[model samples]
Target: MGIPLSPRPARVIDLETMRQRQQARKRLIRLAPELDGLEMVYHLPSESDAYYGMPLLAWGLREDGEVVGLVPWMERLTPCQSLEDPEHGHFIGYRDPETEELFEDPPDHKVTELEQAAAYFEYEATEEPTLIQQLPETQGTHALCMDDSGEPWQLKQVFGWRLYSDGAVEALLADERLIDSTPILPGDACLYPGHSRHRVVYFFQRQIANRIRREDPATLEALALMVMPADQEG
Candidate 1:
């Protein structure tokens, strides 16, 4: 069965908020058993790289039903409403697990007062909205990724995944056609929609930055502004 992506309301609070987040993440790890074999991508920026614009946290699942991630820091995975919230980082479009396509809004669903009260433990139940409701609307954004030759490929969506918690929404995207032709390694660039100006983001890696710095210091210097740090609370 496909795992549900929506956060479950916690009515009982036996643990602290930090522990709750950790336990929630751990529960997700258990749910996604397929995630065990897949590579765990990281973003460890070096001293030469600029700190600005680097991603502080990110999480996502692959179309094949495995979790794929790139993380550099884990500190910023604090519970928040939406992954699109500026506090999290640039919003990589959320992929619908069933249809495997990008989407703008959360799934249509409503929470009843009893459900909210039974699920919420952090605070008194005040008609808490579903976790997916916190996501930003992206109807206008066009999701695209760059290939080795700098060509853009549109991403397809997979639906059925639902948001269960506040912080663990998946917005990272991947394309099989693009990956087959040219694997996206660290330093590869992709367009990040939603920003007013042209914003290019790269999965930051220390070794890749070193290599780029050797071949073209100027390019690396400029790309420093667009590095997306792989950050996870896990």
Candidate 2:
């Protein structure tokens, strides 16, 4: 048998919700280990040096499995982190990880339960994703995409490799789609699916938002707020 499954019931809680979410994420990290070294293909539209749309595929996959993604999503904060105490930044500068900048009187940021759940599903900025995914098996399929006529395209060479989690990734896709359209983790490097990191991140974040809205509406609002661009969130 694989890793023992965690119920992760959606009963809803109060303060302990954070602790519960963290526990769920930690447990997932230890469960599945097969996703390591996997690759997903991203197909972004190219219009003379400008990329448009987000079409994701898988690597080495000849297209036979079931497609599960194609949901435009965005999440502002991955690698969920808590805010430093008021004293910590008393007279110091802060660096915006996304922008990679330092600011005096930096805006405040904290890891909410919603963000934690996102990390649970897909870690941000870090290498490993699916640290808390319930499903361990990945298949290949057409899956839903922004602009797909469902026609087989000619797949070229591997242009990108594991570019989603770290930051911006660009890839050249040459059809056949992934093997069974397997489910790739967020961090899995492939082609840059969206035009910009900001847009892609938001799309994924929205994915998490939909999950919350279904399982727990209470989290949906805060999650929507947090997933906004850093400037907007601030």
Candidate 3:
């Protein structure tokens, strides 16, 4: 008779904690070269902590009591109903295992409760929204960045006088440059779709203004027209 095959043991891993730590470590490693010989301090939230439906890790690069950089990593989470008022709607929050703190930040601003409810139901109602919708859209006023080859680097969405990245429901509070620049309006959408990519390392057009602003999309498109492959020229 054939020997019975033993069932493989299930890998019991805390994925949220693992992801948060990985991102935190990655950010530190990337910035290590920039710190040179200076010792940089990190101020990350205790692990497994959630903030506003996302797992978060905060680190401040400091020396001699002054901060040079602040990096915060937020991980996505599974969808869940709102605890405050279930009849009002449902949402999601990041889950971290290293820490016991849960995020308690507000979810919407300026946008009405009904509007937020609509978004929660239409987009985040299910476990995941359709992939195409999940992809960032380059509509309304935005910050834009382009590579030497003229490809879009990223898009920063603007609402009212405030700007936001696609799917970023709340404004990013840690990036100083983004906070300093004059907020863009909907009419400015065609102006700065991927500009922030030029300043921060590994910046992309689809990313939000988590660091600094760079250039406008129209300018990038013009540059591309002058240098891009003839087949790509429009």
Candidate 4:
């Protein structure tokens, strides 16, 4: 008697999977107008109210009428009262999808500015070539640091790459490695460069990192992975 071999798994076609994705995309396309209308109803502040203290993330309208952004410190699920509205005035809230009725003050609404802005662009159907712009990179004002540990750190001061008269490019980064939950780089007893060749690699804002963690925590895991374990080093 011969032992029976397990049957091979059937080969699968990816067409159905691809079709589902296409259907999802089409659904977003259908909702494009509704998303665009939300912009008119909810107002994002044009400038920071607190000069020294600004939200980690904010959306601003460009001169040509495009909304550009920064990562928000936290996803604001509650509908923020429009900037034009008085602080004590009635705040507009979310609408019931099934009932098509607006709620005056909804508890636990799950919408954020990042989601709303991203969806607006995703829904738009465009055939024209995309116009792109670059935001200026400033060391302390506009950057964050990430070390080998995969935690997001805020920049203190960037002693970035130097292009010297001899044409050699040398760079050094100080790690503020997510200790004590403070995002800013520390003043003393911190990890400096040359300890690990690529220890401090990513320059991202903590708000953006938090958004990624919220949306897909796996992203942080990926960023944290090393090619080889530190213990394996000779």
Candidate 5:
């Protein structure tokens, strides 16, 4: 007799899997809120803080809702002395999800004077107080660099983006790519751009630095911002 062929594995869709997926979708929809009438502000995390020192974008939610803030990951330039020749100056930028305050040690690890000047020039050319007021009550602030001892430093400045929202803060946390060890809570701030429903949160992590090196050393730095469940605070 001919040997019987093994039965092919059945294509299956489990109820639990279906339910979980549906719940996730519903959560996302529930997170979006009407943010047209609330005042919003964006500020870079303080350099003195133990985390979030890289160029980050944070949004403060002023409207009454479950979602209070949103933040997104971003990269910035850092000035450095050429490894081959200390006298000759070269610059590089990194994306770090951890707090910028963490770099307060080994002052040599920080950005260069040229990078600092560039950041200032960019800020001055872009900031508009009147246009900011016209937005549905929106505000923003520049990023501050800190010294080795976690004290505020004036040399390397930073900036961030901001937005207001009516949805649940959990919605912003949906992106697995943005989630890091840093704890994101309901009270944390978030930034959402106009005409976009998904908002991003900025954070600092050492892995982000590694990512910068891997992505682009000369021009661009790509980093991941992760979101963790509120119950499992980092």
Candidate 6:
């Protein structure tokens, strides 16, 4: 009698799958599941807030970081909201399909600001460009520091770069009128420069503006980047 050989067993690959597991989380998906391998994140523009167009896209990760359960996602079964009557329901299939009764009721004011803001932003972005009128760069506020030891120079505020919290200088350098260009927050700051560069001779408001003394150490480095330097201008 001869012994028969068996084929290798099939391997079960483990994939961290992220899916909408519950009704509450259907709109707000988990964030950054790929760090743990949850890659099966399904998303679309519609899953986001109906008013603003911000993508509500994220991965739904499990405690163990694997796709193991089904929760409350109705996107596949019930898509699109009904606009037949604002009072009745905004999300169509969420309500009784036949009678148009809602599965849940949301306040009337919830959607107003989200919708209006989205529309306003779209208009500002897509509409015609706004040209900044400015006078000569030399005429604007001049500022500079020769070095760590040199006297800090300062004048009226310029219409060029404004030092932001994130160490960025957003340049809107072509206009006679000076404007405020500071970022609202550290994250809101620009990562790089704009179209133009203005070599400023800045006078420090304070007597000392050293790296250790200044609030934002990167400010000096950021301003230095915009300069062509007398040596590099040629």
Q: lDDT tens string, model 2, 1-234?
A: 799899887975586888765554432121111122222122223323431222222211001211121111222111111212232111123333445454442122221322334446554434563222222123221111122233321212222222333222232222334433334443444433333322222223234334543756656566435434443433
Candidate 4 residue-wise lDDT, 1-234, digit = tens: 999999999998899998866644422111011221122123234332421122212233322223322221111111133323332122234343445455443222222443454446543334542322112112232223334454443343333322122112223344546344333232323423321344433434445456544766666565445322431332
lDDT of 6 by residue, 69-107 (tens): 111121111112212224222332222223434333222
State how far residue 124 of model 5 sits from its true place (Å): 44
- Count the clashes in each prediction: 28, 34, 30, 2, 38, 20
- How far is each candidate from the true structure, as Cα RMSD in Å? 19.3, 23.0, 17.9, 18.3, 21.9, 21.4
Q: Rate residue 179 of model 3 by lDDT.
A: 49
Best by lDDT: 4
**TM-score for each model:** 0.22, 0.21, 0.20, 0.21, 0.18, 0.17
Q: Tell me the spans in candidate 4 whose CA falls farther than 4 Å from its real position.
A: 1-159, 172-216, 226-234
Q: Please give, for residues 1-234, the per-residue lDDT of candidate 5 as tens digits.
A: 999999999999799999866644432111112222221122223332222122222222221211221222221111111112222211222223333222211122122322343335332223332112111211222222222333322211112222212122211222235444444332233322321332222333334434444565441322211222211331
The 0-to-1 C-alpha lDDT of every candidate, in the order given, reads 0.31, 0.29, 0.29, 0.32, 0.26, 0.28
TM-score of 6: 0.17
| True lDDT of residue 178, candidate 5 | 48
- lDDT score at residue 29, model 1, on the 0-100 scale: 19
**Residue 92 of model 6: what lDDT?**
26
Report the C-alpha lDDT of model 1 over 163-197, residue by residue, as the tens digit.
Answer: 33332333233334345434433222331121112
The 10 consecutive residues of candidate 5 with the worst lDDT sum are 75-84
Comparing 1 and 4 on TM-score, the stronger one: 1
